[model samples]
Target: MEHAAPQAWLLLALWLWPLLLMALAMRTQWRWLPALGALPALVSAALLPVGTQLSLPWLLLGTELELDSIGRVFVLFSALLWLIAGIFVATLMYREPIGSPSGSNHFAQRRFNALFLLAMSGQFWALVGVDLVSFYVGFAIMGLAAYGLILAYGDPAARRAGRLYLALTVAGEVALFAGLVSLAAHSGTLTPDPSLLAAAGGPSLALILLGLGVKAAIVPLHLWLPVTYTAAPIPATAVLSSAMIKVAVLGWLRWLPLGAVTWPHWALALSIIGLLSAFYALLIGLIQRDPKAVLAYSSISKMGFLLLLTGLMLGQPDLLGAGITAMLFYATHHALTKAGLFLGLGLYEQNTHQRRTQQLLLAGLIFLALALAAAPLTSGAAAKYLSKPLLQAAPWHWLSPLLWLMTLTTILLMARFLWLLRFPASKAGWEGTAAHPTESSAHFELNLLAPFLAWGLLLALIAALPWLFAPASFWPTNSANLLLALALCALVLILSKRGRNPLATLIGRIAPGDILGPLERSAQRLRTQAGRFQPGQRSTRSTESTRSTDPTSASETALELKLRGWPVAGALWLGLGMLLLLLLLAGAR
Candidate 1:
């Protein structure tokens, strides 16, 4: 029994290991602590058996770790990816050559290490968690900690991306929380409850769907992703897009009513949205210049497929047996491939003379995985084959074409992403060596390949999983639709090369945060208006002119300048006042 509940120890170790590492990292001469930190959780998760459950009555949330078959798939996949990225980050942990020497304690900062640890804890906890509340705590902590990374690194553009990410993330979290609340209120007393959540009926189910929708980067909530992925450091972007985002998927898997009533209408609507968003992101991705940005958009496209799967599963909760397996298989596929690409792009920055060679290699890998996304007869093809029966049963067969379109666009985007990610050597020698980096050693290259190789191994498992478990008779899969889809995508890419320049043309025309452009512009306009209205502008002009003529205005102008600073200061003070009043109101209530 003690061994059976080992997940409790695993859960505790996930949190405590990082904290210990961070504390040790704080005291040691170590600069690359982040990379070393993710190891224990990864190893423990792999060793832990599926169906294990753990409880901690002492904690506020009473920590839980339960492993369903699908959750096990996600846990191992996510845990491995995080560790690999951590290692990659560790390789670069020493200060940039431009900074102080290696031995300097300043090479690492405690704050950055702390945030990384907290984020990793959140991610690990979320992956292994059994119930809704435990999952939420992990999810919230990870989200907040990741925001810290954004603030730590982003400049003006990064900050804009940060703000966009934060706003959308908060909105998503709110929806998810609402769903949990509704679930707790409605579930019948007879139902068994997961430690994290009290069960509610359909309304709670709806909440979980909506909440997961935002976090999962489905359709409308997906816009912030490309911006954040583009702006973040390669390592940060890799984990953020790949592993961190899976938190939402895990959330939906654990919290939603998979075995309860199916919502076909909602499911259908979601499938349509996923189908469209999947293609739409690729189209936009095709036109973009930055490869990281392209990968971000590609992630959105890939995530949409998962969203569609979620919809289908919701519609036929009874099919959860196959549905959960399919979903797990699909999630693992995307995580590995996407993380590999993000890290590969980061490493692609290393090659100098072989730009075209690198580009060709990159394009091959991108399309290979994207084809998997399309379920081209490669293992992904088989995965897609499994999904067909579910879609065929839906009210309309036409949805299949939509699915094909999603697959085809993924092919096009994958091809386009390769071209965009291609390192153009046209300006070759003009840029310095920094722009064209080299692998520090064979070891470094191998270190970087860790995540990609891990993904490739998982993709290999696709062919084996269905055979071992369900053992369905072969339907004799056909490549005709797959070929037709690829050819059409190729033709589209060739004929519409002109559209590739649209990202530049649309930059000012379309803000990076998708629909938030208008709001951002409005705020900017308001600032401009405020700048003019403030007597500060007029006073500044007078003060400058007066410095040459009337000395008193210049002196008073300095006073005015000091007073202008007070507005920002005053705003802070006012914010504090408002906060105090709210706290008082809460106390009264």
Candidate 2:
């Protein structure tokens, strides 16, 4: 352990070095350095031992960081994502035209690298930190820094997404901070680790879940995900969905003591929420036309499955060890596969000229899609194999059929994603400049090769994960389940191809953010109504926007104006808090 201390210092350096590099980027012209910024973190994660610990007594009233089993895996994969995204961004900077102010790409490049590094550093530290305070610090830093990445393009849509992201982030942070403070107060320690506390009460658990749920983008809390990812750059979307979102899962694993004590109510509630989110995302995802939007909903659905697993673990505390291992495997598989899918979109968009290259890219996309859909012999199958125990257990037996349905839904969504990719939303301004039509075939080939190679390596790593971690004999038993799921997916596909599918209309009619669209419309109505009721306003129903000919419209408008002083939103927020408190009290009983 003493000898391992040096490597742990490397872990600290892993995060801190990014900040130093970020500072350097502002002063230096070298653009290649930021691409390599994630290298140290990757190295540190590879070399560090499982129990390596480091304390920062001088910082934040003394904090501790350690590379536990879960942390080790998280840091390794997260660093991998950061490294890949960094390379992609660096390459892209060279391709894109310089921004304003005398045509210098320096400002654009520097701004992105600085924010990217800050977010990466926060991700690394948040995973490595053992104590609650340290974790929250890292979490908040990452959440705040990511807003810049979303707003990098400075488009109207990007700005809107950034605002929404920040709003949700602040709300989540407040919930988490309050929960952490209350937990510490209850435990009589300012720096309580998950293991130090008993089974937390319902209020504490609910608050933590509410906070992290926003980050995780679980169902009703998932509106920001699609909007932001669709508007952000490809690299930003890749890392944001693949690596950043999973940090919330890690928070749940650490903040809540899974095996320490059982709370069936919280567990059951989480399972219900998780399952609903999964189904909702799938149904809405089927209608999504944008490739990135499809991917975003896919991520939401995947996160919901993870939430389901979390519930299973909580419900049956005896299965904690297996549950955690399953979750880690599932996370790893999803991260790699999902990131590959997102990055593949970039590859598809880049090669628009050559038919051969396009065909090859399509093949690769299908392969990646199959991987994500958990085809046999893939990492997804291995992960599913590991998680099957959850359904096999008592009281959770019903989840078996539901899990099967979820898998089918996932397959359908993946099919929709492939279909959407065929006709991506056009790059409005960069349509002609997006690809160099006259560029040499060799250069285009090389550019295409780089991303595919990255995907290939990641897929290979995922394929080998089961062998490296799980028993060698597990694959044979898992094959049958995989085949059955594939068969069902094929049946669905065939029906759709023949134009006989009954659900096609529902898929086409429903938007990506299924429930959120209506909620937003309702809010907009409220705002409009609130405006009309101002003192001394025209009593003629303000026929400016609405027509004077429609009597019903005028009446409704008048009624809305009359009731406009109501604090609907504020009251809703207050009611939500009260509901949570009531749930906690009930759970305590």
Q: Can you write out model 1's per-residue Cα lDDT over 113-163, one digit (the tens) per residue? A: 656777888877777666556677678778867875655453776777778
The TM-score obtained by model 1 is 0.77
- How many residue pairs clash in all the candidates, one count each? 10, 0
* lDDT of candidate 2 over 156-237, digit per residue (tens): 9898788889899999999998888778777766556556555446687678889999999997889889889888888888
Clashes of 1: 10
C-alpha lDDT values of all predictions = 0.63, 0.76
Error of 2 at 83 (Å): 0.3
TM-score of each: 0.77, 0.84
The candidate maximizing TM-score is 2
The Cα RMSD in angstroms, rounded to one decimal, for candidate 2 relative to the true structure is 9.2
